[model samples]
Target chain A: MEIRTDYADGNYTIHVDYGILEASISEYIAAYSSVHFLVDQNVYALYKDSLLSFVQHPIILEGGEASKSFDAFKHITETLLERGIKRNHLIVVIGGGAAGDAGGFAAATVLRGVDYIQVPTTLLAHDSSIGGKTAINSGHGKNLIGAFHRPKAVIYDLSFLETLPHHELLSGFGEVFKHALLKDEETVRTLMDATRTKISLDMMKPFIISGIETKMHYVTTDEKESGIRKFLNLGHTLGHAIEYKYRMPHGMAVMLGLYFMMYASNEKAARNIFDLDSFRQYFELHGYPLEHLKAIDEVEMMTLMGKDKKNQSSDATGFVLMNDFGQCYFTEIDSNQLKKYISQLKESL
Target chain B: MEIRTDYADGNYTIHVDYGILEASISEYIAAYSSVHFLVDQNVYALYKDSLLSFVQHPIILEGGEASKSFDAFKHITETLLERGIKRNHLIVVIGGGAAGDAGGFAAATVLRGVDYIQVPTTLLAHDSSIGGKTAINSGHGKNLIGAFHRPKAVIYDLSFLETLPHHELLSGFGEVFKHALLKDEETVRTLMDATRTKISLDMMKPFIISGIETKMHYVTTDEKESGIRKFLNLGHTLGHAIEYKYRMPHGMAVMLGLYFMMYASNEKAARNIFDLDSFRQYFELHGYPLEHLKAIDEVEMMTLMGKDKKNQSSDATGFVLMNDFGQCYFTEIDSNQLKKYISQLKESL
Candidate 1:
């Protein structure tokens, strides 16, 4: 499936298909005179023969979250400059979210701006690739330094997902679950049915397309994240805090944060769509990191959440909370209210 | 004078007038919910009372080229995060080119970008403020990492120019001279006439407007610096090399680079529009750093120029050479040809 985000400047396409890499790689090379590949090291080790067949030189970086640092960004930039990469050249990032964030930012910056393509290898990248947000992590938080630079295209080869570990698959599903919950009840039902049996790469195609479609709906309308795009941060507030404090993977933290929001809504005396037993059962079956939250103190978690970028005040936290499915709104939750919600979640756990 | 660059998103205005600071500061504060100032330390020390009247807590950074470092960029990002600066908040940068580059880049990346206002305090800032190009320097080169983030508005108060050192006044004229030469013969004549007398803040106003006007004309038409915008880099190829190697100030280096291009064109049997004695006389009278080039070797300079972001090949160099006034084109010169031109320039000196 080819999803085109038609903006006034140009059309940005997200191509999702199995075995599309070889064909799309050549197409990108033909369009750009200078094409530099910033590939993940682990991905390179696995697909080096395939990638080397097309491009002779690829800058291989570590595949994990540590690669998304200022040092890595500066190193990539210097490497590109040494290679004589110009503004008109294309940088194709072939990695997961970390690779896209760092490499995309480097491309966005080197010589003021350059065109970049995202070839995501991890399942977690489904949501990240759709949005134009590119960043390197700051010591204070994740994605603190970045820009809204859209990729030239996103080549999502589904075959890569077959190689993903179960935990990685679970990580990607965290976002899938968020999209399903935020989008509508119908999407939620579709997601539940898809996960009813063991999830495979073949069965995941339709859900990946829907996940991207749900995200693009928000992105195309608000590219800058000034309006409805803020709704897309549904699980990210406390998610980022937990992710930072515990060094938990991004999607898993969001998964826990989603549960927290559900509890918070119920405490605020709002309708709870997440009260269903299947929600809890499915999360447990998939090995979501809910047990990690049991050890973390509520005050420490609250302090981390207060430092979130979306918060208007340092004392309070802003949440993209939903009283009902498909109706998310941002609200400021004071420390007292946050403490009450935390106690309720702890008791239930 | 009011200059408006009509981008598809919104109108970017450059307000150039005497005593426009207080009124414009209030106007910007009225528009943004939270306003923070990223001020140059030198500028802050000189104008603390005036700045405090507008903003209570300002992030004071060291003024000059030192501020345009990756460390400074990182520090500013951490500072903003610590200050609880949200996406909707505005970052008002009040300083020269370095402060603008660092602060603007921080604003461009912090929370994936926030609207920034440029309150320029130097004569050279007239050029930097109008363009949305923001960046920090990498170990490889100056401005090797950055983004093309235009400011919401550029407030250029003439009062700041009065406080500038004599060398800085000469420094700004380098760009003004380049603009006049690139713009038209009429602008060139106006610039020459203005410099014939003892230059003051009042006399420089119209020229600053014209320099910004020339830049905005190119920026509005080709914001990405693909085609016509490359004309703006007429002196920057060798200018950046010299600036990088010797640690010369930006505008003074451009002044030398402009002269080199003129000599190269004349050596290539092109008509010498740069054959004016007053041009050399005016430069000497204002203390432009021309003697620095005498000590630097041609091979070292050529090697530095090869790594320029504009060059496609490592061995070859691209120069924005003007055969005639107001008519410039890009051309590739091999190392041997570059060596010959440098020797010719040495002979003339």
Candidate 2:
């Protein structure tokens, strides 16, 4: 079933398990299918069958975490320029979260922002697809270089998610946990009840709405990620540093950070949230490395967070610590206290 | 006097003449002023004393029409890549038409469409400044490389006009004539009546408004510059070819195109709208050459136009020609007839 999720700000649709991709694309300009933005080759090869069955021009790019760089952006843009992809054509970016972010930013800037559609092929995409956020990496940090240009549309086809590895799928679930912890109640309950090893399209409906609802709410309110919306970064400040330093996937690092922050936060602040023990047990049960935080440099990790784009002022470091399920704040935690939490966690671990 | 012109779709401000050529830039996160994306060496030397400038970071570049190329875009983006221009900062572009178009597109694609402002120095900019059309030239053609990203604001300071030569002053008046011919009465009457060799800021006010009104009318109606808005192109088809071939300035070629099209148009389409004899007399009185039409190659010009991005389909020839003053249409004239008109003019001249 092809269902379009609509909102006041924008609408995104899911091209169910079958022929809906072609139907949705036909509604757009004929030139859209020709946009050849850079994408990961692994993700592309896995999904090219479905995309070529629908997309006219598919430019497969080399993939992996390392591909997220300015060099990559230039290479892809130059490729698109060589192909004569004018501003009139739409640059459909298909792949995982990083692909969406990097390709989306590339499309956003190439010829000064061409039209792009996000055909998310991974579980992580439910967060990346809706927001206009597009960027590549500088040596500085993840998402340090990027832009806010909403895609014309997002086509989420559940069929592509079949290729996601078990780790990547669980990695995507971290965001789902976040949405529940930060906003709605139904999300927390829904994930708590997941019994199946593989998440189906039917199983993803509410979480997708809840995730998009959470993301769009923040985007509309902050639009720029300037103030309140940084609350969405709850576990990210420390998690990003861990992801950077240890070279772990973002979701794995975030789980470690989430486990640490549950105690690092004030007891009153974290009360009535998901049972911290269960949160830890569930990720561990899923075979995620919840204790990776013990191996990294606490001081370096703390210092690297001051490097976060979310840092508004030098003295204050932004933290999206949770108070309870459905409540959070993007308030800053002083470096001194953050160091204390880091040291304290290290000692306990 | 600083008077702002709002185009409903966008807005601009005209800072009337003053001595010392004062030009100021205040960097902001908004789409107009920033130090991130601009190239202004001549402007800097000319107005540095009176300019107010602040940017998170500023970088200088060698300036010229050549500086507005894709190579220039690469250079500036590399600088942006080097300096860490977040998508939040606008790229303040100050200069004449070329800088506005090139830098605006750079800002558009850099980080996926940052904000930009135009500080138009040329008299002809009274027309180009109001619309969001921006580009860099490719070997393919003038404005063949570009995108439609409107400026957040435009500052039309008459001080920039001081650098213009007499020919340039006359050349700029083509747009003033264009605005009048396409729509505005007061502007035409004012231009016809002005005997002062130097136009004062106050005297230029009505013409600025008329240009803004006319272009804005077309842009808002057709932001893409496709159907009705192509009417704004009146003489541009032949004019662009003339500019490309003869290496004439944009406005001069356009005036020549207007003259011929006016003469060749059907009587019902012509009538009292354009008196070709007086048109010849007026430009001749103003030192414009009446003989360039002799050298125009009708076959080549028509062939070049077949590749016009505006021509929708096939071997047809289209013109944004006039039904009368204040009325224009994207009418497809017969290729044979258009060719005959050009040949007849070539023979007569």
Among the numbered candidates, top DockQ falls to 1
Task: Give the per-residue lDDT digits (tens) of candidate 2, residues A1-349.
Answer: 4445444655555453433455566676464534454557886666566654555556665575555675676567667665666555777777788888878866765554677888777777777777678776656567765677778877776667666787887777777677777775666766667623443444765676667677767766776666776777878888888888888877777777677667666543645455656666676777778677667776688667766666644555677766666777667777777777787777665
Candidate 2 lDDT at A290 equals 64
Give the fraction of native contacts in model 2.
Answer: 0.10
Q: Model 1, B336: alpha-carbon shift in Å?
A: 3.7
TM-score of 1: 0.94
Give lDDT: candidate 1, residue A51: 38
lDDT for model 2, please: 0.67
Local distance difference test, each candidate: 0.82, 0.67
lDDT by residue (A1-349, candidate 1, tens digit) is 8998866576688999988987987787777778899998888888777633565689988777777887787789889888888766889998888888888888888888889999998888998988888988888788888888899899998877877988888878888888888878888887778778665566778888888998988988888877888888998888889889988888898898888877776656565556735676777777886877677788998887776766667667888888787888888888887877777677777
Candidate 1 off by > 4 Å? A49-55, A265-269, B49-55, B266-269, B276-278, B293-296, B313-316
Positional deviation of residue A2's Cα in model 2 after best superposition, in angstroms: 5.0
DockQ of 1: 0.71
